[model samples]
Target chain A: MAMIVDALSWVFLLTGGFLGVSGGIGILRFPDFFTRLHAAGVTDTLCAALILLGLMMQAGWGLVAVKLAFIILFLSFTGPVAAHALARAALHGGLMPLLHRAEDDPSKS
Target chain B: MRHIISLTLILAGFWLLLSGHFVPLLLGLGAVSILLVVAIALRMDAFDHENQPLHLTFRFTPYWVWLAGEIVKSNIEVVRCIWGPVSAISPTRIHLTATQRSDVGKVIYANSITLTPGTVAMRLEGDQIEVHALTRAAAASLQGGEMGRRVRELER
Candidate 1:
């Protein structure tokens, strides 16, 4: 059981690290707020949630577990709202999304 | 009333779990958690209906399980898009007029929209959601309307 637990923790840690990296890279490399929003969403839900679940297992029945669960609950509820608000704010601030050239052709527009 | 009790118990139990002992710590946590439960119950304009069939839990579990699979699938899709010569991710804006009634139901709908790959809920203007989708497929999925229906059912 302990070995299995250890392995699971490592797996979660690795996934979290990957997500952290992906989200970070997306935030940096993505061209627009919308694209970056995709990155940020994945990081929060997939990466962060997985990592925290792994950490919760390691914490056992202690307060760390309790605290971690609270954080996860709060994050689950708030993360999407935050992203929605950011995207709206960005749009309101004049961040026009880039369109595909063919789609952007004057005939289409 | 019911929610307050459940909240108090959960908070106190969690507090004790974190504190990892009994006596003064446990009792003190019990007092604090009870206070907090009362406070939160007041804040939400909440009522005694904590007994509502945790339908969202049961409903969204499978939806989320499937969603996780969908995320992995979409992640692969996005990676493919990013790696291509043109990085041909077509950024498109879409308007979705929602059918969900309650605020919680609307939220579940919006979050589910955000949860799926390649889409973001830009804003909720009344009953309509302004979405920025990364591709035509993503935009189409939002318009398909299955998720909204499912969330509406869950809310009931």
Candidate 2:
């Protein structure tokens, strides 16, 4: 059981690390303001979730796990909502849309 | 009502974890501390989130872990940008479109933008973010779509 838990932890840690890097890269290298928003949100939500989950497993059955779970839940709900608000603000303030590359524009109109 | 209890439990649990010992005195102290904090919270009227339960947190832990790495990476980038030769620096202003609708999300996005290397969220005027980046690469990073998409996913 301990080995299983340990393995699970490693998986979670590695995946979290990978996503964080991907998100950082995505935010750093993507093609527009809106695009960057997507990257940041992904990193905030998904990357955070994976990392906490690993901590929960290592914590085992206890308040530690519960607290970790609480954090994850809070992030999941709050992360996107915060992102949404930020994005909307950016759009309304007349930030540049990827005129040539926005797949969302045609869909919105 | 429920939120109060929930908050108490959370506080107690946290207190215990931090204390890491279970003598009668410690346990009594933990309970008292939890009560005091919860009382203060009540006085502050932090009731809305008191009822918040742990929900779907496990689902995104991995992503958060990865975010830590990004923070670290960005830290390096920021240091290099600020400390490198002045000739390597290029001050720029860029506007990125926003696609979110919640205040919390907006703050997080803004903070994250500032947290990353080479960028500062100078203004969040409506939908456009007036950002200042130390370099073109930093400016371009603001243009990326991944952050926007990820934030949207979290909203869902």
Per lDDT, the best of the predicted structures is 1
Count backbone overlaps in model 2: 67
The sequence of per-residue lDDT tens digits that candidate 2 reaches over residues B1-156 is 766877787677667765668899989888888888878988777645432333323344664555556655654554443334435545566677767676445554665665454455656757766665556676786788566566555545
**Candidate 2 CAPRI assessment class:** incorrect
Model 2, stretches more than 4 Å misplaced? A1-109, B1-6, B46-60, B125-128
Residue range A7-26, candidate 2, lDDT tens digits? 99989888788777766766
For model 1, name the residue pairs that clash.
Answer: A63-B18
Off by more than 4 A, model 1: A60-63, A101-109, B1-18, B40-60, B82-86
DockQ of 2: 0.06
- Give one digit per residue, the lDDT tens place, for model 1 in B1-156: 665566566666555656666788668767876797669766765554334333345467777776678666666565445444336777778788888877667777888788765788877868888787777887887788877777777766
Residue B133, model 1: Cα distance from true site in angstroms: 1.3
What DockQ does each listed candidate score? 0.43, 0.06
Error of 2 at B127 (Å): 4.8
Q: List iRMS (one decimal) for every candidate.
A: 3.1, 11.1
TM-score of each candidate structure, all chains considered together? 0.78, 0.51
DockQ of 1: 0.43
